[model samples]
Target: MAADRLSALPDDLLQHILSFAPEREAAASAVLSRRWRTLWRRESALDLDIRPYMAADEGQDLRNSPSPLDALLSDAVAALAAFPRRGGGTVLKRLTLFLDLNDVDSSYDSVDDPEPVDDGRVAGLLADPAAAGLEEVLIGCEHGRMRTTTYGLPLASMACAATLRVLELESCNFEPPLSPRRAFPCLTELRLRHCFFKEGCLQAMVDAAPALTSLSLDRVSQQPPDSAFQAMPAYCWVPFRLRCLTATTLELKTYSVGAEEEDLARIGIELDMPSLRYFRYTGDAIKLSLASPAPGLSSVDLNASLRGEQSQWEPTSRMLVSFSSTRALKLHVNCMNDIIYGEEEHGGAILPTFPNLKLLELDEFFEYTSSSAALAMARLLRSCPVMSELRLNLNMTRWYRDDEPKTNDPARSPFAQSMDRFNRLASMTASSRRVSELPAVLTDDGAFTCLQTSLRKVTLQFNANELDCFQVQLAKFLVENAMVLEEMHVDDGNTFWLDHLCNKLERWRADSFRRRNLTDTARFRVHHLE
Candidate 1:
């Protein structure tokens, strides 16, 4: 025996080590020795993933009997019941449970028959004495694709509201507590994804969680306005107002509604987070408005399409103005459609100057063939006077290239004709018109302070076998113009043309130095994306 040094460690430390293992494996450690038998029972963290224990459903028929999912749930409840009680006992600090029922064929099964696993039993875990001081809980459920019902989590049954600090729930109906006061008194972080809220449940939950500092709502929706619950008091639907005073970081994404409800959805968003420092929003349309300026907000990322309705441009303009104080900014290509076309239509500046911005990242989803993209790039460069780094992600998928060899095989005629039609449509819809010359913002002397002095690093990402002419021109323009640039990185996401791409980039480096009348000190390199 090596003096059993590991066993000599403190009991709490040993339990902490065991907590990382699966619950069943951790409990199995009890058979090792007398000292270890009870140590696993006192562990403070539990991760109950029922996927491994689920029996194979390939050939088994579960129509008449309770599902393995139900069995696992019962086993989990029994395990929780075995933990030590409240007074002077070990307090569970964290619990994470993941239940996936995508393989089960339970669409036609009646809820009254097998008494679909009571959601309250899972929520009641918080009421157990073992969870007296529980601080974190993550519950994720993926129901069968064919099933019509969703799990309804009973929020009122949670008993660790005063001590809980973090909570996350996914794919469920969030039922608000009966009383809002003192609910989730100590909670500081909350995330809800793919969830449905009752008429006013979300508002009440927000009102109750006063100490919350971070919140994320992804694909969260509510029932239609015609629900039976709205019959009382002649319930009039209102825009979802998220008025968090203490939250410093917030994310709202994909707030989608039907076309008939588009006007209501666009009515507006009310945000009152005075201390916010970081904000990221992703959607196809605009629906956000801050109640007041967040003086402390410093970083913002906006990912939305601004090409459709004129109504979206004004709100986007207002949003950019509010984010003028931010130091870092990222914009998707769809966002530039509005700024570029709006500037063309209105013949004026459609964006505010980002005086404080030091870093800028632009994301593109298609091949860059028109000068509208160049103009958009120029306008952004001119706005950020002191930006030091620039990143361009040209995630090109497919496009028409006239230089490529044409196919003449009769067997591929149908597919080739269809692709040619698609190529034409993409080109026509890409921009209303095209121009030959680079925008004056790039050609004129002293037009951009960032390019003249401050800009030091540049990164361009491409995902194609060959670079588009527009892409090559943009790269050449940047290399020849950025006087103080020290490093230029080209991420080659191509599969078969790595060697060709590398050689072409080398030539660009030589040509840029020769054109600029400067020494080429190996300032650029090409990297392959794995």
Candidate 2:
């Protein structure tokens, strides 16, 4: 080569290559070539994570660590100060700063009013004029046990909110901007997890962000908005704005076991998302309500926990019908059977039929083998009209669709209704039921409808240590009932021990059966109990 290929590239291209790389890898790039040495310093993003290093050394306690002007804070401050002051080619586009706190006074002063956080070095960087072009910023911290701690970050210190596109803060308290000014205009995405806002600042920031497209409020504080704020005006209808929201992705998780549930009122009681595509909720099922039908939703994950008294809560399957249009759903609840079957724990309200569901995951699936569980499960199986894939957590049982169709049992009467159609010759004396009896039952029987589709896969979780009759029966039932199954993958998760035992049992059976016959020429085939 006439010249080195790396040295021939312009400075701008090299800076981009370094900008996209991780902070550690970018530091290592200096050894590649002399020209690439200083290019990392000129990159557009500065993502510095010093938490691991600090956690490893374990030498400096929070009360005794070097001041923000001396340690990790100083490095961040210096990096911002030296970030290219030339004719303006590449400015700071993104900044991510992560820190860990081992104690309450982790190198920052403790205050009671605004927040308990202290980072003078970050404040110093924000005050510098070089940070005026910053577009995105994420400041996250980790406490010992994820305990709530408010960080004192003055909005006035950050002068780049007008240009900021994404802002995410965790374990901190954020104060709104001062009066006689607008707030975060170009912001598109905002994620607040375990963060606190000053009085009235929460609603003010929501009203000010004119271009927000994605918002996630996971366990956000329940503090009421301030009645008097010098910087922002009031909205008479805040819930309506949330109902008519246009964001594409929204995640809401609430943990109301603390005093906030008793003191603070619930905000945004009904979700009015029309443009939502993905959703996840993980706490307190009794708190959610649908403002209108969410026709655009496609994915949902519900980690439901019942709080307060079950008698006071209306366990209506109707609330979940809003998500009938979803393509995938993961449900983790202890009382799901109660909702599906409308038992004594929950009112006897049958869930509506879902015509668009494809993949359904029922967490704690092995618990559905008891009389109550089986009855509830039968009801659920009869409601998913178009479901194709079902994931269950099976702990070694030979249970199948028809293993114990307890038609005589009062609890299993709903299932007997579906099985009756398959065995209609035994039930109806006229050879066929009247025309009207067919539609009301067949049109609503999901188990009968599932057999008509292209259900080809049955995946089960089992164990080698506890093989039972249900394991074999489930496979037989799927092969016979599904009618079009092509694959049945069982993940025993114990390294094929069950398969080994099945082989040993099969060999033993064959030997014992062959010994019983007087003739050695007699051919024998043996089936294992497993």
Candidate 3:
């Protein structure tokens, strides 16, 4: 009955159904009945996963016999070749092969040098003019090394399929002198992950694909030259009209002006794309500048780490000025401490001004004095007139105090009297009085109130025990300012003030009951972990 139902479906629908099944299962389905025998062959998209097939053939001791890896590769190539061609001679729309070639622990010797698998049979299939109609190809394999002479995909044998648009290669290698010369004029998207190329091979590949629009390169390395470091050529002058680019672990040894110039020149070079928005670099810091401003860019993430006796402080600071159009910016400065306080320091005033900026996050390794921090905050608030959110994650673990006391230190007296003075100061500060209005001795409470008004949400994830007096003052300020606040979450872990907070929230608004009722039916729970 199941077979009958499957057969009743239209040819297109049946093909779609069979495409979802594994290659082995799809092939086995043919034996279900006569009508289903050729159904799998009609699938336009072929997905062959070799791991399960290899694992199921456990009884075949090919290790002590002929090479199992070679046999497996041969079987896969043969299966693809056996697929029937369409009336117009087209093979398939797409072909995806996912393989896991990791060696089992059963062997003591290294399997790195597994016998070479001849891909001539597969190359012959790809070379066929009828099979050239394939539009997309994805190949993913496990971690392994390919010989310098062994090319995984034979470009010479591959027919120029104008229909091919997308190609992805993961954990694969291309042999040296890999000049395929075949132009993928219609190809737009190319992704290469954990793949290696011979020197000048990448440039050659990029030159062949003029229509490339989106390119993702991750963990791609080139063979080192005798000079130790040499700048690789910028292959894509205008890669397939590329608009989105993500590059990681691009190892370049030499620093050349053209390398930087070419990179910056292509900032807003897209001719066909208006939605090209993201530009992300997660590896080594490249000294590339923006050519034409990226006025359309909404967000930019730049992570740069440079090595040198001289500081990259000035150059980095200057580079930021180019990204004036970005509304959201995340910058990770590697040598922040060294550069910020160096002898020839470019003043912190060099920090870029975000005119239309609303959200800002600063992750720094610096000790921020209360006065310095306040000044910096004032400048930012003044600059970003519409700013609504600010997050500062600082590492202040190394702050130390001098043994010599300041002039304002309390007299060496009873502990209770000293505590009384401190509490009084806290209370005065948390009262929200103007900075000029602060008395000769400011209270901790007055200081807390002043900070509370500027922040909608403030989270302190460090030790609060040392700032107990300040915490108490801040808690009182929260209670008083509860009307202006929409949400107040305090995670002091010191339960001494939790009850006070709960009571304050309960009495401040009767809407708390409404929130409790809504919580019962909500699918998502906002957990406040203690």
lDDT of 2 at 274: 69
Judged by lDDT relative to the true structure, which candidate is superior, 1 or 3?
A: 1
Write candidate 2's Cα lDDT for 406-452 as tens digits: 33345756556446434533444442321111122222445556655
Compose the digit string of candidate 1's lDDT tens values, residues 45-116: 788876765655445676765566676677667766666652346677888888775554444332212222
TM-score of each: 0.77, 0.69, 0.58
Of 2 and 3, which scores higher on TM-score? 2
lDDT of each: 0.66, 0.57, 0.47
RMSD values for the candidates in order, in angstroms, are 7.4, 12.9, 11.9
State model 1's lDDT. Answer: 0.66
The TM-score, computed over Cα atoms with residue i paired to residue i, of candidate 1 is 0.77
Per-residue lDDT tens digits for candidate 3, residues 86-171, read 33343677777765545432222221222223345444545665457788878776664432112255555566446778878764
Ranking by TM-score: 1, 2, 3
List the candidates ranked by lDDT, beginning with the highest.
Answer: 1, 2, 3
**lDDT of predicted model 2:** 0.57
